[model samples]
Target: MVPTIEMTTTWERTCELDDLEPGWGEVALLGARQVALVRVGGEEVYAVDHHDPHTGAPVMARGIVGSRGDRPTIASPLHKQVYDLGTGACFTDASLALRTYRTRVVGGMIEVELDA
Candidate 1:
């Protein structure tokens, strides 16, 4: 596994898990950068860097979620580039990817793991 950087100090609560409805996404600041918190299939949740990996634009959070083969991914709204939510890997281009953050729900609150 690639070394996961400590994105924040402690797990900061962004919102309630219920706030992110299934098949939808929400944008929140996770430390110094914005992140897109996506809820897929009503069971899986993903937190990825909000910027589009291909264009460096703050648009990933607004992308659409879909599946390719057996993997779930998001398509950038600008250029339609897709990114794997689990690994932040761009589906079409191996040289590009976004940063991913670890997250969990605590007492109904959505928390993003971070460094102290």
Candidate 2:
């Protein structure tokens, strides 16, 4: 699928706030896109690609969530590559990165703004 390059887009409800847990992740389907949703603490929610770019495996939802310095991160289960949950920057490598979605909570539901 072609990715849209527009400046901004509408927010889509991905899941309920109760569906996630801290230090863990879940998969959410956004049309053809597969996203990994994770709840850190309080009402903070983060979204990234479910597929790991390094291993080409759809196991990012099972990745371990933690912090690398000041950035929250998810380490890939396959190769132990740490990726920043906020910016999707791979801490293990400067060349690799994950796609992060903008997330927010509204009325006890989680919403993500997909790039368009």
Candidate 3:
């Protein structure tokens, strides 16, 4: 597992827009940790910790993505746990949440922000 701090701040290229399939997520190693790169919607991508904070399992990537009152979040497949995409806070339980990384499109490539 890679440190959450490193993955959150480092920029890594996981895949291209056409390379990612909708409704699915891919795991990438960032500075010794595994992170989930998800294609939530059309041309929209998100990065989150592969591990589910609620179950302690690396399965957040397999979760579904949707919005809850304008907030983007992923629903864990293990226990149906919901987490905020921007802040990585568990919606169901504020205390439990996986870590999220900063994602953006730069020069037509999807990049994740890693720690400095």
Measured against the true structure, the TM-scores of the candidates, in listed sequence, are: 0.85, 0.90, 0.81
Q: Which of the numbered candidates is closest to the native, going by highest TM-score?
A: 2
Candidate 2 lDDT over 1-116, as tens digits, reads: 99986696878899889888888999999888899999998899999999998978999999999997878999999999999999999999998999999999999999999866
Model 1, span 8-101: residue lDDT tens: 4577788987889876778998668788999885546888888887888898878999989988899999988888888888888888988888
As for lDDT, the candidate ahead, 2 or 3, is: 2
> Model 3: per-residue lDDT, tens digit, 2-108?
75653334578876777778768788877787899888677788888998897788887788878799888889988898888878888898789678888887776
Please give the clash total of every predicted structure, in order.
Answer: 1, 0, 8
| Superposed model 3: Cα runs more than 4 Å off | 1-9
Model 2, position 39, has a per-residue lDDT of 96
Poorest lDDT segment (10 consecutive residues) of candidate 1: 5-14
Task: Order the candidate numbers by lDDT, best to worst.
Answer: 2, 1, 3
Question: For residue 39, what is the lDDT in candidate 3?
Answer: 81
C-alpha positional error of residue 25 in candidate 1 after TM-score superposition, expressed in Å = 1.7
lDDT value, residue 42 of candidate 1: 52
What's the residue-level lDDT of 86 in candidate 3? Answer: 78
